[model samples]
Target: MNYFITGGTGFIGTHLTSLLHKVHPKAKVYNLDIVKPGTPLPAVKDYKPALREGKEHAATFIYCDVRQPIELEKVNITPDDVIFNFAAVHRTPGHPDSEYFETNIRGAENVCAFAERHGIKKIVFTSSIAPYGAAEELKEETTLPMPNTPYGISKLVAEKIHQNWQASAEDRQLTILRPGVVFGKGENGNFTRLYWSIRGHRFMYPGRKDTIKACIYVKELVRFMLYRLEHHDSGVELYNCCYEPAYTIEQIVEAMKRVTGMNVNVPYMPGWLIMSAAGALGALGSPMGICPARVRKLQISTNICGKKLAASGYHFCYTFEEALADWYKDNNNQCLE
Candidate 1:
């Protein structure tokens, strides 16, 4: 078996690649992305590689942008290969509005086209909870998407493209996982930023204490993706990948303190004031690491459900607390300011 991945250098992609190497040791894995996973992760003690069919696998990283089908054209794709598409312009504060579409939407098109041309019918794509937008009500799989940003809209569009591609062929098996704020070791995004904030004694509640954030551990998400790929019963499937009973920011803060021993009695900062400040910063090109719009986003709840996946009988290995503990255990020495 051969595995092909787009955006293998990314945080989630990096973990996915490592886990795949352990589970399918002999299967040749090709990572088609513009960059490598960079510095090798310190090997975990007692790491167990997946031993299936008495074979092991290896992974090879290749520089290829998903926007150009020609870049994928040269790869020796075959019928037994599975494509995992994780490439997207997801950094909320860094990229332009157009960059999101050019990469996310167009990249989906190129990937779908390549798959159709090569009869590579199996695909697992990672989308985001951003598509559901900031809903006051809990969002389930049936929720009508109301994407607010270019990134969210592009992901919603990409989901449709994958759906259409699946509809065009009877043999296609597509799985679209709309994940929330994925966190774990090597996740240098929201969770890690929070770590530094707590360590620096700078963490403050942004308005309310009950602002819910949906999240998944990187390894747990990858494990589920691989499980679905191997034991899939065919047909298209969509699942929101996140912790159930989504934790509040306050809960996350407490978890950080418990896991990392970071002490911070973060005070509440009003939303309006933060928004106004963020707006001013946005106007000044957002010099501050925390943008005003993002400050506003922090106040909103990203409530989402993984009921569909849950009902499918796949048990998640990590809850919010367990996932936090896992990260702290892995990065025990790196939790400081």
Candidate 2:
């Protein structure tokens, strides 16, 4: 079997591509990404083994943006190949509103179009929990998606596009994983931002103490996604890819301290103070990258659950605690003093 992965150099994509290399050694692999080999996109560079292995094993890196299918038109894909679509402008503050829709929604349309054109029958898409939007209520697969943000709306649209693509064919299979904050080794965004702050001895807490963070380890999420793809029948199979009992702020802090063995001071600053400081820093060019938006997200609980994934008859290799330990071993933050 052949495999085609968009954003193959990304956190989840790189890990998934590596697992594929180990399992399907003889199969052809195509990494469709804008950033090619030798250029260590900061996030991809953190996973050193992936940087080396992806270059060696993948049949080719088709240099192109998902927005431009003309560039992908040159690749030798076939009907038997399975496409794993992960391309998206996910960093909330990094891009403008239109850029998100242009890249995410348009990218989704292009990928499905490319697959349909090539007669590809299987696609595993990584959607986001943002689609369900922020709510105090526990969001499951059945929860009506009322995405408020540009990112959330785009992801929800992408899911619909995938569903429509599958509906067009009787034999096509579509597996959509609406994952929460996925983090492991080499992750960026919230988890990595916190890890870096803690590692540098600059970690702090907000006034809110019990905010629940819905998250998944990258490895486990990928494993579950692959399992669903293989086991589920032709048609749309959607799963909210995260743990049922999500971690609280206290739990995450305790785990981080235990894994890193660091005694970083954790002081509780009022949300107003933290947000004010972040806003002031942003106005002053944010040398420390103090993000006010991140501060807001940290304060709220987007309590999500994966009831469907848990009932899918697959065993998880690592729990949140084990996941922390595993990454801590490889990270440069473990402490002795």
- For all predicted structures, in order, the TM-scores are 0.89, 0.91
Model 1 ranges with Cα > 4 A deviation: 39-58, 71-75, 277-288
Residue lDDT tens for model 1, 141-160: 99999999899999999999
| lDDT, residue 329, model 2 | 65
Per-residue error (Å), model 1, residue 48: 26
After superposition, the stretches of candidate 2 with alpha carbons farther than 4 Å from their true spots are: 38-59, 70-76, 332-337
Candidate 1 local lDDT, residue 49: 22
lDDT for model 1, on a 0 to 1 scale?
0.79
What TM value does model 1 have?
Answer: 0.89
Steric clash pairs (candidate 2):
none
Q: What is the per-residue lDDT of model 2 for residues 1-337, given as tens digits with 9 covering 90 to 100?
A: 6888898867787788777877788987888888774455664223333344334534467786999773465556678889999999888766789988998999999999988888999999999999988778888889999998999999999999999999999999999988888877656557777877777866678768798888888889888877887797799988888877888887888887777776777778888888898899888876556768777888878788877888999888987888888777655545211
Q: Listing every candidate in turn, what is its Cα RMSD in Å to the true structure after a full C-alpha superposition?
A: 5.9, 3.1
lDDT of each: 0.79, 0.80
